[model samples]
Each structure stands twice: as C-alpha cells, then as structure tokens.
Target: MRVGSRRAPSAPFPGLLSSAQFAALAAEYRRACGFEICACDSDGKLRRGGAERPSEGRSVSDLRKHAVSEALRWGEPSVLSDGIEGVLWAIPVCQNQKLLGGLVVTVTRLRRPSKAGALDQRVVSACRVLLELGTRYNLVNAPLLSERRETARREQEKAEALHLMKEGTFDTIRSIYLREEPALIAAIRRGERSAARHAINRVLTAIYMLGQSRIELLKSLALELVVTMTRTAVQAGGNPENILGLNYQSLSRLADISDQEDLAGWLCRMLESLIDAIESNSRLPGSSQLARAVKYVEEHLAEALPREEVARAAGLSPSHFSHLMKARMGCTFTQLLTRMRLERARSLLVHTDAELAHVAAACGFTDQSYFTRVFRKTHRLTPSEFRRAKRPIRNASAPKSQTSARLYKPGAAVRC
Candidate 1:
C-alpha cells in the first residue's frame, strides 16, 4: 500500500457478526432455514448502515423495531419478536456495555402455527451457529487485537531503530562522501543516494531490530538489494553504489546470495519489482510547512497549478522552497508535480473513458499531443490505446473528441 491505513477507531463490528464469517456457512444457514430476508444494526441508530432484507420499502414503524428495540430490554443476546404469521430474530452484538451492532433474521415464515413453532426451533438451532459470531467477533478479537497492537508497536519500534541505524550508516557514508565530519551531528543529509540507501537501510533496520530471532526475514530480498546496489554502483563508476555497497555488505550476512551471479542476472525483473514494492512510506514526527505544501500539491495535481503558487502557500520564498521540499521528500519540487500529474493522468486513462483531450487538460497538460507524447514516454502507451486497454467494461465508452479546455477562473489558482 502506498499509504498506510490508520488503526480502527474502535473495536470493529461485534464478534458474533464479524465471526459469523464464512459465506457458505451464512448461506447454508439461511438456505436451509428458508429465510426470505434479514437486517442487522447496533446502537438503535443502525450506524454506518448495514445489510437490509433484499430491496423493499420499509417504514420505520412497520419493520421489526420490537426486536431491535430489545437492546434496552434483555441487554442483548438472541431475541424472538413474534408476530401474527412469523418471528424475527434480533441478536444484539455488544462490548463493554456498548452496543456495536446485531444480526436480524427473518429466516423462516410458515403458514401453519405448528410449522411456525417448529421453524422457531430451527431458528434457535441457527442461533447456536450464529451465537459464535458474537463470541468470535468479540472474545477472540480482543487477544488478536492485543497481539496485533503489540506486533505493530514492536514493528514500529523496529522500524525506528533501523531508521536510526540507517542514519548512522548514512552519517558514516555522508561523512566519507563529504569527507568533512561535523561534530555532534544535527542532521545527516546526503543528496542523490538518499532513496537507495534509505531503501537498504529501511530493510536493514527492519531486519537488524526485527530479524534478530529469525535471522532470515527478507532473506532473499536483502541479498538482492545489496547485489543490485553493488551492480548499479559498479555501473555508476563506483561512486555512491560501490561505497554504499561495501558499507552495506558489512551490515549483514547475505549467506544464500554469495556465488549466485547467474541467479542474480535472472533477477532484473525482481530488482525493479523490489523497488516498486518499497514505497516512500516514511514517518513525520514533527510539523512541517513545506511538507504541508507538498501534500497539498499531491492532493490537487489536476489543475495547471504553478510552483510559485505552491511555494507561496508553503510560506517559503521560491529560492528556498526546492531545498525544503528535497529535504522532506528527497525529490525536486518540479519532479514531484510531474509525478503527481502523471499518476493522476494514468488513473484517468485506466479508470475513466473521459475524452483523451479532456483527460490531458485535467492533468494540467498544455495540449493533447504533448500529453500523448509525455504519456507514451512515461507509460509506453498512446492515450487512446491506454484508454481502451485499461478501462473497465462498463466505463468503456467511446472517446470524446473535445478537449475540456476548462481554464481556471480569475484568481482561483491556489488554495492556502
């Protein structure tokens, strides 16, 4: 994932519902029980909204409010709301005196009273299976959540430690590169090799702190990074890569990778694949204005926004803006804007059948032909071909001949 997802705000859906997991099981329970429809919710509000019995108009007064309302009565568990012809099962899912949600089943409706009574027994039996959802969703989740929390906490700590070690590695390399060791290092900065070394250090740091016990986390991958770094370094006339490669080799035992040059050559795809897999998911512990500005640019790349405008928004003079952006994102600001625009353009080509010209204009291109050339250069596909090839079936409409040409209104260029 390019972006990390935040931890869930609260214990997610109640265990019983979450735990009633398998599709086949839920299907079988309903199919065998002859359920025509069902619904579920929690906190009386039915928050976040949930499954309702197959499409139908249900007035608030007409539906099974009695059973759902029972959260105030039995404080949750299975409940049967009896009506003239059938019964609705309302099972409330709660935790810590909080009603998370529930399962409502209109599983069976029989014409005969005796049959209805018998099916009620069947519903009770299904509840036995479903009651597990509450338990599975609730009880089991606690330990798993704790385990995950601890694991993430440990992983984050390991990441931080590796980050510090990489800082040390860079400090050493940077000191050698600059050949000017400054005392009490305030900031460890290197210009070009930042990304590669960061990648190696990220894994190395992860491995150093995390892989101590296994000694084989990212085992094959580590060797590949070092070797790739070595070859790329050699090709670059032994500048950063060679110096960094030697520094890296001393960091760990790439035991299985030695004497495997042919295997290494077969790994061109793997080398690219590995880099693709490692996204720039670094952390920000402190506040940053330039970071904020870059973030704004990334979020809104569709408009033909200017660098001066963005720099102005960041409250930095254009002279100093690029340096600040490089410090944070490790890339020049223009490169960032181009990347963001290209990404958005790619998304449009792949996801929407918006006219090629319009897509071009939306991505802030000056003209359609220029967009096509740049698109081909970046993605190796012409605009129309990319649209036809990448678009989904429903969205595969014919291309629009008109370019959007939607110019910005006066003074609506930048947002602070």
Candidate 2:
C-alpha cells in the first residue's frame, strides 16, 4: 500500500479520520469484541465513536476527554479507570514518529474471563488497523492538531485562575467577623497572646479571602477592623484615651502600608498593644475573689461602698476578704477602693474639663472639699493644679515619696 500521502483524505477524513470512518471502525471493533469505542484528536476533542455522543445524565464527553489526555500524556496506549464508569483503554494514534490522536475503548468489568480474553485480542487487532490507516492518510502531520493542543492548555490555565478567584466572597467576611471578633476580645481580656494571635490570623485570612489578595483593599479592611477592636477594648475597661491614642498613632503608620505582609505585621502589633492595655486594667488572674471585690468597688465608687457588701459580692466574709485583700493586693478593701477612686479622679481631671464637684461625685467623693483634700494628699497636687500640670499621677504606694506621705488613710470617715 502507498504510504505518507500529502493529499488530505476526502470529506470525513479531511486531514484526520472522518466521523463515518470512525463509526465504521468502532462498529467493526464492537461487533468483534462487544466493547464500546471512541476516537479523539490530539487536542482531546472527541472526533467520533460508538460512545462519544452525549447521553442524557451521562458524562461520556468528559470521560473521552480524559482518555484523550491520558493517551497524549503517556505518548502510548494505556488503560484508564473511572470510578463510576469502569475502565477505558487509551490507544494513541501515531504515524511517522508523530502523534495524531487517540482511540478509547471501554471495557465492561462484568465480562467473563474467556470472553474478556477474546475481546482483548479483538481490540489489539482493531488498534493495529487504525494505526495503519492513520499513517496512510498523513493525519499525524496536520498543523491544526498542534494549534488545538495549545488552545486547550491555555483554556485550562484560565479556568484554574478563575476558580481560585471565585473561592472568596463577602459572606466569608461576615462569618469570620462574627466568630473571631468576640474571641479576639476575650483573648485580649485574658492576656493570652497566642490565642489572640490565632484569632487575628483567622480574621486576616477571612479578610484576605474576601478581597482575593488585593493588597490595597486588604489594608483598608484591616484598618477598619483595628478601629473596631480598639473601641471594643475600651468598652471592656481599657483606658479610652490610652486605647484611642495608640489606635491613632498606629493608624497613622498603617495608612501608609501597601504590602500585605507588612500590613498583617502592623495590625498584629496594634492588636497586641490594645491587648496589653486591657490586660493591665483587668483584675489580676488567680485572684478572682479579690478582682470581683475590686470591680464592685470600682463600679460603685460614685455611691457608698460598705466593706460588708463588697465582701459578700466576692463570696467571702468581710474580715476574711479584707485579710485576703491585704495579703494578696497589699491593700484593704477600703484602701483599694480609695486608690481606685483617686485614680479615676486623676484620669477625669487630666483628660476632661469636668468641674471639681462633678469629678468628686464621679469618683465617689460626696463632698467637694473632702475630694480636694484626698486628691491633694494622694497626688501632692490640687485637681486644678494637676489638670494644669498635665503630668501623670505618681503611684500611691511609692515608699516615702512626697505623694505617699500625703496619701489618705483608708477607712477614715470623710464627708462622703
């Protein structure tokens, strides 16, 4: 037989095998082997076959495409298995050392042993005849086949990129905010850095997904989250001025950040600082009872704080609670309450323009005069002088310091 003809095969076999030719070959194979057969070109497109037509509710096309891919990948005949559809023999069609397309033959798993052996022999014979026809038609050298393969590869890459981008959504942000925001606050309150970090990371990841890796947009979203966190920490008892101040300074730097990694690092640092402030204002861990009593006094400082009532709230008798407070905190209930009130008064004086009477009432001192006396004694400066000085208050427990000498004695009856 003449081989390597440059003239394209007529009609159904223009440059490659036609549908009629493929069908005839498939029918002949199936008649002899009782197996379904299909053919595809180098680009993994189904050309023709007994099983190539799309059936309702069946993925025959996808199976044929996969078979074509397998044949091309291995550059030879091979067996391919599908979970739901059983096995396929992917036979590559090559001529003059060049690939043209593939032949895919379906094998039923239920066939008996003797029948299967006979079918295998028929399949081998059909593949040999197909290869010979491919060489004679010069189908393997067709330029269209190479173009189709390149086009398929490009389409696959584009599909993968789209899939990645579609994975994120606005709903993810809402879910993460609901789940992680509270956890982040609780972790900060407990002073658990690792837990706080984990919560923040989850939030960041959610935000990252929402924006699909857009660096500028992610930074903007992160800054907004930081603002919300700062407010939450303040509401949880962190100093408003301190928390807000830190937030402002951090935001100044954060606004300039455009890199994703830099943005995450800056946000983490900001969160850690907010957590530190909250931890500082929080009651000491392991002193639950003392913390409760102290919290009660702090909250009720604007009213009368009988030691009995405070101790009861802490689940301890007045005397026992007082002893525990002194041992663990180095201050009696009355002294601690006084110290907390003084601290509040100082904060109001320095941070606000409230009148001395209002400040005294707010700090739990009933009489303005008594409030002045105690404030001056503890801080060594009158409220007006302290506010005007704009200086931080000295620690009341500092030994023999000017402020310590002037400290108000706890439990001494004041006009309040």
Reference-based TM-score, model 2: 0.31
Error of 2 at 234 (Å): 1.2
lDDT of 1 by residue, 15-53 (tens): 433323434334655544445323344433332223434
The whole-model lDDT of each prediction reads 0.48, 0.64
Per-residue CA lDDT of model 2 for 1-416, tens digit only, reads 78886864333334456656766666666554456666666655666544444434546556656666654554334455455445566655655446556776764453334654354333444444444444454544334445555555545544543454466433644455665677676666555566677677667766776676788878778877887788778866688878888987887897688788898899889988887787567654437777676667755788767787787666454666777777787766667778878877876775566899999988887468778888888889888998888744333334434343343333332221
Clashing pairs in 2: 12-18
Error of 2 at 260 (Å): 0.9
Residue 49 miss distance in model 2 (angstroms): 66
Worst 10 residues of 1 by lDDT: 182-191
Q: Give residue 288's lDDT in candidate 2 (0 to 100).
A: 77
Off by over 4 Å in 2: 1-175, 283-286, 289-416
